[model samples]
Target: MKGTETKAPGVPQALVDLVGDHFLEAARYLREIQDAYPKEFVSVAKKLKVGRRKAYELVRIDRRFHDLGIAPERLRQIGWTKLAHLASHVDADNVEKWLALAETVTAHELKMLLRGTVIDPETRAVVLYLDKVQYGIFETALLTAGAIKDSGCLLNREAALTRLLDGVVVE
Candidate 1:
């Protein structure tokens, strides 16, 4: 998000400059690749020596800066994790405020503020119908992932139920 222009504290200025250039170039190339082939984003990511997740973050940084109201130079300095976290909050009016707040807090504190207990397991639940095979596979996967009971077993329905999303974050 576009905020007041200033270099971030405690990082080498040279690295900040490099990040701005690199993210811009990467975003430009990724946009071209996506536009030309549409389905080759994965291949583009592989060629760039970055994971799909990191590639997505870079593109988001590039393409959404205007929408997110973030300056490219500011974007380069905040790093990917905070940038991605801020994505949900930034908008034309609040971008400046968010950036100001980010600067005042540690990265961890900024994250905690933005996260804000929305994903607390105690406050969430889901009910769904899984087909027999889907249920079976889900159960097996959970067992392998150690979500099963201490006795090493789960009811058919409980397999996917036991922390199905316990440590898994879909976003």
Candidate 2:
């Protein structure tokens, strides 16, 4: 993960230089706390001033990076969010490829790529915070439109939503 001279495409050298080593230091410290104080680990999020999820993420990043022997500077350049997304997928052999990909894409896009989703830069996401009743209605519509499965997984939500919208007859 370090000392490899191959530069990631679309990531400027200046941008990489702008990223500091603070995240790597934080990840290392968090990991130390996790290993030394396993019992008191639950309070780590409060201590770090981050949500529980983010605290755990840092620990995971540190552990994975350490185990994989990834360079701290390389991880710093990639940043925590992307590294966290990559932690589970990267191995010694593939770390550089994944890090390069992370550098070229947004974290959300990287997650999608890891999930086997094709990256379409033009495609966008829309989020809605629906109440229980509204969620039920929306779920039903998606189900009927074949966007979701009986197992409650999304199949092709964008296509389904497009079909649903296209069905509306204008006055």
Candidate 3:
């Protein structure tokens, strides 16, 4: 499914410049992955021992599937062979399986998978890791990190959630 309409607002331009296009792709991919394996996503994130924030970071940079340049619809037709090609760039561990599952899902199924799954027991940490490892720190993470840097304080899940929910207005 496409991402939720919940755009992150108030992001700084510098952060956007730092992250670039990859960030957007990563965010999109994360939504897709989550759609494919709602329970598995949470389980894997827990297994990886990453918190919600760190999980987000990891998934963001983990763009093996998106980088393949295959159309979402085409993914289902080609299946694992296609996904395997995409998985080459990112870590091969769990992605192979995730991509395979993604191939079986429809856009509407993906959307349903993400609904009510955005925030949960392990979501915050998983999202953070996804952002860091998979997508890399993009505008959202950079702005968040910068805010913390300026304040001389670290922001936790509650803080990040608040800002994210508030919406990061793209300039």
Candidate 4:
């Protein structure tokens, strides 16, 4: 379960610059996790001592190696109640939100939401401003948005969102 290289050709220099060193580090971490766990999120979660909900949060926050475990078939097989059970281990409110969001979105839509704009302009601008003080903030926002879009569940979404800055390039 190696990480598939996501080489978006002609990606803007600004975006590439934004990605910088940390992106590589995060990517490496994801790859390591994939190699070790290989599509066994539940088992990995147990080994990490992360509750099911926390594991879902981690998966949602990062999709680079999400395919390692939690296949689409397995996800489809999990009923709402069971999904809720897993989510409840982290945050019950997030579980409901994630489930609801999942109902309205396709995987493509989730991907788009992660890399594209889903927030209003003013908010985006504010986030961009804040990100200048801390570059890592923007990356977290991007990841959190991806998590929310992908898992359809997120706790501290507002906090996660606060990390983004409007008009800022985050690779």
Candidate 5:
């Protein structure tokens, strides 16, 4: 996957710059708050207006990755969700391999892999975040194209997208 790109198409470059690796910064700030107010950390997190669960998750990832000396660049590259799955298993010795694996697989598949489940090496995953209207359009398009099934399983959706793309001609 060396030549493969991780793209956020339709997202503004300025927005991307402004939001660069924000989760890493959030983790750092949350850790400082935790250190200053050990007992009231959860309350502090709540007061910050972020969900308590998300705050805890950020803290956990921060502590684990910080203690392991994982670089911010690498963490940003792997993204938070996949890093959560890799956190327990990653160390100085195996960090590179785990990072590469995380880059190649989706978070769900990475979770399954960590749990000793076998997955197809050739399988790839794409994650999308769409607004309500965008999601409606996308769902309709895929459903109309017969890409999505009644059950709407992820694998089926993936296959549908692949099949649709296979017919496309790119210049």
Candidate 6:
């Protein structure tokens, strides 16, 4: 992905220049500086108030492939968890195939596909990248469904999802 392209049309050139892999490059440069003078990073972190992990994430995200096969815009849409998660499982030759599958499923769903030792494809699963309030609503919905069922069995994630998709089917 050395000369990889990003889907950043319509974005300001200045902002685009500042972010993306270039951002990673900058982070790498900073890490190098810190390596040269270890105490300097402490000052930089204190001034910016960024933790060691935040700085390391930049390096990690940078040291990774120049591109994980998905365009930058698609990456923005899917988020890093999915990209990094899938990238770890597939070799360079199969990265694109897995990434294509990633677009068809939520990041969480993709995780399930990659990591779930036994996935029941007959029973579909839905995964959402929801914010705190949104997750609260989802949790409430699951609880409500369980309360309504009242079958002396707990409403686990699958059962709740099945109830939600009772009349909905995807080909």
| Candidate 2 lDDT score at position 145 | 87
Candidate 3 global TM-score:
0.21
User: lDDT tens string, model 6, 9-80?
Assistant: 132344335544444444544455465645465555434444665655544544454444445565556555
Ranking by lDDT: 2, 5, 1, 6, 3, 4
Worst 10 residues of 2 by lDDT: 7-16
Which tens-of-lDDT digit does each residue in 77-146 have in candidate 1?
Answer: 7656676667668777787887787777656567767868333334433665999999788767877665
- Clash counts per candidate, in order, are 5, 0, 50, 10, 0, 0
Candidate 5: tens digits of C-alpha lDDT, residues 1-171 = 564533222323443343335777767667777776566667655555557767777787888788676678878988878877776887779978888889887888989889897888776657899999998877766665676455544335665666667778585
Residue 82, model 1, lDDT: 70
Give residue 19's lDDT in candidate 1 (0 to 100). Answer: 45
Q: Which ten-residue region of model 3 has the weakest summed lDDT?
A: 116-125
Instruction: Show model 6 residue runs off by greater than 4 Å.
Output: 1-58, 67-70, 120-171
Write down the RMSD of candidate 5 (Cα, Å).
13.4
Each prediction's whole-model lDDT (CA): 0.62, 0.73, 0.45, 0.43, 0.70, 0.57
**Decreasing TM-score order of the candidates:** 2, 5, 1, 6, 3, 4
**Number of backbone clashes in candidate 4:** 10
Instruction: Find the candidate with the highest TM-score and give its number.
Output: 2
lDDT, candidate 5, equals: 0.70
TM-scores across all candidates? 0.51, 0.65, 0.21, 0.20, 0.54, 0.41
What's the TM for model 6?
Answer: 0.41
**Tens-digit lDDT track of model 4 for 111-151:** 33444547443443133345454755644565656535345
Q: Which residue pairs clash in candidate 6?
A: none
